[model samples]
Target: MRLQTGANNQDKEEIKKIAEWILTVGEGTAEGNNDGATEIEIPNDVLIKSEKNHVKSIVSAIFPSIVEHLNDKGYFEDKAILVPTNEEVDSINEYVLSKIKADEHTHFSSDSVCQSEFIDEFEQALYAPEILNGFKVSGIPNHKLVLKEGVPVMLLRNIDQSNGLCNGTRLRITRLGKHVIEAEVISGNNIGYKTYIPRMKLIPSDKRIPFRFHRRQFPLVVYFAMTINKSQGQSLSTVGLYLQRPVFTHGQLYVAISRVKSKKGLKVLICDKDGKPKNTTTNVVYKEVLQKMKEDTTF
Candidate 1:
């Protein structure tokens, strides 16, 4: 379900261009060249680059002097740097975190392997506490969480839906305490509302995993930047698509570009496999899947 139009977003011709290419590619008509490859054209004006150092350039363009604007909810509300992979997301977050010189506080979690009748002691022994601590499961926080005051972190679980502390909620750290972390909601209806986040026991929700385990940790992740997969269904005013490497999955390139509501708020950075400057990137679309769906839907 793609967004045809976004409320409060004026004039989405830029979005239309991106969406059209995605549709063309998805519908199996974009490969007009003899080489059997499709390269979506990104507008020159929106092709963001200032000489070298592309990551810093995009980060600066999205977040300028973030240290000083920690108090401003609007600063992090509409702005985000989106990456294609988790490694890039972590790199950008670290780079942004280094820019802030505030003292850091670390929060470590307790990890344990859940006892399942299907699993044996040998399997359980393999997943030691140290090994469990290092596990990076989707929708779960890390074993060690380092945070500072006024930085944005996203909620990974639905602690309170009525109060708007749901999954993917963004909040800025207002105060750090021994037992709890104080933060103000930066996204959704509860924006500017302050709340306390408590440590909770969470299990791996990712289906790709073979075993079940629990980790007692804060359900949060630093939101300076996020991966494209995680950014799905998130609406933002300004978004920087930091595609150091091109997207590898079907509709990912489309999802990344379509996140921004308005034409003026979207900026994309694309490069080749060698990491050189480039204006175009491959767009993956499974026309066979679309055809299969069409056949299934036929009356």
Candidate 2:
């Protein structure tokens, strides 16, 4: 389903900025050997949070489109769609469901299903393999390892080049001391002619599972616990960071604040006059959260 947007021009600007940032323009030259590999200790807490948030974001962004297409074809309100069981999810299941717009509106479930399932049903499409010639697609895009036998490697994917179509995707991963892999890249098709990610690091999460998508609306409650000290190194475009002295750390606060690309990307929660952590969290969106609170509380 096509998203009718009155703010096409505005969205184009935002998209352009996002693309540019991802491309890493004006970034430095590529560094280190082409073949490198190392294992870094995964911070259990950080991985848990990052993976969860990353997956949920991807799912929310992609699922709506799938649902919209399905609804347009009269799939919404259909009874044949499988409803995942609680048992299936706990022991051997990791399925999730949320309301979405297919063409009109519907519910989509991610249970006992593989990426191929979505593709088979035309719910989603993969980037043409040919377009990703230089990169390998032996497994799912994120599944393949970037290094082989302690050698650095690349993962290429099709990306929108500011100039025109690129030949392929190339992401360089080099081994650093302490079992770390520093990300670097050389690509003619997309952003950054040569960029050395000196501090870029990857810490595998438990099970080495890649992030998956989750689609849920706000007022939406997720059943997971969150802690602060676990977050470090990584940055986020948007985040709602919570802090409470003893349980929280300065390092976490710093990382959380830096994750956002700009001031518009952060939200902070502070205690109130009553000395209680007064649910005073605010997002650094275009509008102020305090104004929203006033409006929300006025009635």
Candidate 3:
């Protein structure tokens, strides 16, 4: 299911636009070599959405990857301004009512819109949006991409960078032996001009003590949710997207559907009023890529 921030996010028209933008802009280019062309297109008719359930597994793993890639690529170049509909207004009212119930000290009238507006005003007062673009995503590349028992698992380590600071390092769990797995750290933390490693004697699967820093040493692990806006700049090998109208922007629909390397790699779930995949627009670009891939791979 797609992530919704506020009640207004359930709009379908807006979701389609955002999805389109993602399809075109998110998967536009890549870092490595594979014909340094400006853009690439996959075949049409790849069955991006099926009547049956064939894309379940691939969807589970790919959504996170797609989100990370987009953040790396700087998809959130512009701000999204969302206007609420009547349905959204009602939702906000319901939410406000619930909040009022939770805090018995505050009294609220039956007017849902008034309560909702008051809550929105209070929340909006906290932080405004920051304008950002073209920032490299660190830490992700440090994690190793390896397989354990035929299942791929990304292994990461928390390493101490001098002066009470620690950065998590990562390695792939390559070959699992009786006690350890053969692995190597792909990336390490950089402090000032020097780079450091797990030089104190370490092996894969070894449970080491956490580094201490200034009475608190290591940096806390932080997780951030991926928004459709930030995901516009990535090129995903495979993608599973949730569509809703509330987060819509012009070209956003295009962005969401076109991230996959091929149509076969794309899976989309369109949520209805009941929060199920009952209402969804057919992804045109996904179909196009699928058709092309089949013809090329055909013997």
Candidate 4:
């Protein structure tokens, strides 16, 4: 499969070298091997990075065009807005739900059984909202739930991968029940097909917290917006990347930009700390990882 990007000269050269090395290694024939290895070639324009302010410009210049394309394809009927963190996901979900006039918000109920008797009051207090907020800042499977028919959502677990109901799979709610939700796959091979999602017990682990707690809830979240990390393995038809904060980790910016199948389907909004538009964007790439790959040519 060919992966394209809009990267600058430096990044393009580095990516090209990496892609060439991968092709060479994969197609190299082993000693005493009778069968010839399958040859794979990397496309010349496989990796491209958007120029500085390119994404912002595209979003501004073609906002209406992109919206028209989405509307024509019925993408807006079901879509995923990719963000950078869980907190942002929750915040955006709340905002979208509020705007749509959906008021039903379900909070997860935790199991009260204590696992460790050694847990003191201080350690137990870590699970409280005031304390847990500090730790739950970046975890998975959100504790709060909001359901609205026709809203897009993402599965948090692998209920059935072969059937396209897996982690990061996007779906639109067809029916919402107290114990189960019926949804139609909107972005996978099973698009237009429906599936049933049931409430399940979820345990979140954070090193900052001393004790663990289990919360029982549906394994899904409003995918109107989701963290970029959670969107790694999924292909989105229409992607709105809201960068309220600059991405801090390596490959985050790349991953976020590359989620959409094409540039026409992408819309990026980069905001400053004060939520205003910003001209420049920050990209974090660890060059050492590339150096290591170059040094280890034996593979």
Best-fitting candidate, scored by TM-score:
1
TM-score of each: 0.87, 0.21, 0.28, 0.68
Q: Which of the numbered candidates is closest to the native, going by highest lDDT?
A: 1
Clashes of each: 0, 15, 46, 7
Q: List the residue pairs that clash in candidate 4.
A: 5-48, 5-49, 6-48, 6-49, 6-50, 7-48, 7-49
Q: Cα RMSD to native, each candidate?
A: 3.2, 22.5, 20.6, 10.0
Model 3, which residues run further than 4 Å from truth? 1-58, 61-225, 244-246, 279-299
Q: Candidate 1 — which residues are off by over 4 angstroms? A: 1-37, 117-121, 292-299
Q: What is residue 247's positional error in candidate 4, in angstroms?
A: 1.0
Residues 1-299 of candidate 1 have per-residue lDDT tens digits of 23355433554555567667545655546655211236767778778874678888988888888778977878898678888777787788878888888889889999887766266678767877998898877678778888889899999999889999999999999999878989999899989888999999999888887778899988889988998899987988788987778888777776777777666678888777677778877777676666678999996
Question: For model 4, how does the per-residue alpha-carbon lDDT over 20-41 read when each residue is reduced to its tens digit?
Answer: 4433323232122112222122
lDDT of 2: 0.27
- Candidate 2 per-residue lDDT over residues 1-299, each given as its tens digit: 01112336656666454334322211211121111121112112222122233334323332234334431322111101110121211211122123321122112212222333234444233323232222311112222122211111233222335542222233332223223333333323343333332212122222443322321111111111112322233233334443222122112223343444433334443333343443322221212433566699989
lDDT of 3 by residue, 1-299 (tens): 13122315456555454444443443332222222123223223332343443223223333334323332212211111111122332232233223222222111111111222233565443322221111112222111111222111222234434432233322322234433334333223321222222212222221241221111111111111133443454444445554433334333445555444444445554444444444334232334454566799996
lDDT of candidate 1 vs native?
A: 0.80
Local distance difference test scores for all models: 0.80, 0.27, 0.31, 0.59
Clash count in backbone of candidate 1: 0
Q: What is the TM-score of candidate 3?
A: 0.28
